[model samples]
Target: MRQSKRIAIIAHNNKKRDILEWAEFNRLFLAQHELYATGTTGKLLEQELGRPIHKLQSGPLGGDQQIGAKISTQEIDVLIFFWDPLEQQPHDPDVKALLRIAVVWNIPIACNRSSADFLISSNLMHNEYQPHLPDYHDYLERNFQEHAIQVNRELPFPVGTV
Candidate 1:
């Protein structure tokens, strides 16, 4: 990760005020990084912080998936998502997938105000840190080999003889 981290901020409907307040309190620290947010959250944060934010579609409309894609590609370094646990979201699967992708990519994530505070205040946030990336080559090779064997077994002749 670079010293200037790429941070993605998101908030569910009920938790928007909390995230906005937290963000406003930490505006100076947040301003040092590249910020991204979903539609309404982006607009709100931009107005509060008076800074430009990279805005994506609303969460229900695929913003979570967009952030997940960025995480997979190593374009985002941190995730601060203030999701309401009590309220069930219509796009819950996307939210879960986004969280899973963040973990899979070994990036830092904060789900609430307390966690976000700790994340931003950490010394790692101000410096470059190399996160370990798990190798999936073996996994991919195994799946491909299995598929080839299955294909050969189902065919009238061996796969290469065709």
Candidate 2:
């Protein structure tokens, strides 16, 4: 099994209550590790869990983007976001980006209550999950060169750098 991990929780306005209720039910299991969430969702979960959470901006205001960056950088290991399917949100694109990133990174994601339940109940999920993140200097440089040449205009990569 893995070690400890950073987890991000997010919810749509309409689904905030559901997330809160779910968190409340599993507070003990959740309290053991790092927690992050969007503004309102974090606030509500903190209030319900009586624990501190690293809160990002509101979803529409870039909270989702903040979480996305964290996940992309492998700063987040688990993503349990309760999205509202019936309602069209202004931040749908952000949600899609986050979901896509999660998939690309092979991080575990729970989009609904049932999957969330399965995750929280799993021994591996609750025990610990540590990601082995190595130096990204070369990786970042290569990616930047391939995808964002402008972003690396100021930096230089050494020969055979890893």
Candidate 3:
């Protein structure tokens, strides 16, 4: 059997219904894991599933950042976010950053019902799936080396010289 994972669920205003339906469809599978969500989404899901959820603030009020922080700290194993592409959010940057963190952490993220279905049904969800995470320390060291080389080449130049 797959290990119980910490799953975060988030949905935009327009995509809430879709997420609710998808969650309902996967209730059994979801019940086997730890659940978390943003404000309205969390309340709605808790009511629908009759299960407790670790609720955070509304997205615009910092929920996305909260989740991102958790992802950075390896607190979340999966992300199921149904964001509305047809709509614009005031916290768009926060949303993007949250997604970026998930990617950087090599977490499994599902952006839609289809992908959610696939991910939930995949054998990896129930089993240990080791992700190939980037060696950021090495990358930072390489970047520092490159920056030093560039700085060395630009040193001792005349102030007004091209």
On TM-score, the stronger of 1 and 3 is 1
TM-score for every candidate vs. truth?
0.94, 0.78, 0.86
Query: Model 1: runs farther than 4 Å from truth?
Result: 155-157
Q: Write the per-residue lDDT of candidate 3 for residues 1-162, one digit (tens) a residue.
A: 238889999999999999999989889998999999999999999999999999999999999999999988888899999999999899999999999999998999999999999998988899877767667999889999998888877889743576
Sort the candidates on TM-score, descending order: 1, 3, 2
Which candidate has the highest TM-score of all? 1
Off by over 4 Å in 2: 128-162
Query: Judged by lDDT relative to the true structure, which candidate is superior, 1 or 2?
Result: 1
Flag regions of model 3 displaced more than 4 Å. Answer: 143-162
Tens-place lDDT digits, model 1, residues 7-96: 999999999999999999998899899999999999999999998999999999999999999999989999999999999999999999
Candidate 2: count the clashes.
Answer: 2
Q: Candidate 1 — which pairs collide?
A: none
Candidate 2 versus the native: TM-score? 0.78
Clashing pairs in 2: 3-129, 3-130
Q: Which of candidates 2 and 3 is the stronger one according to lDDT?
A: 3
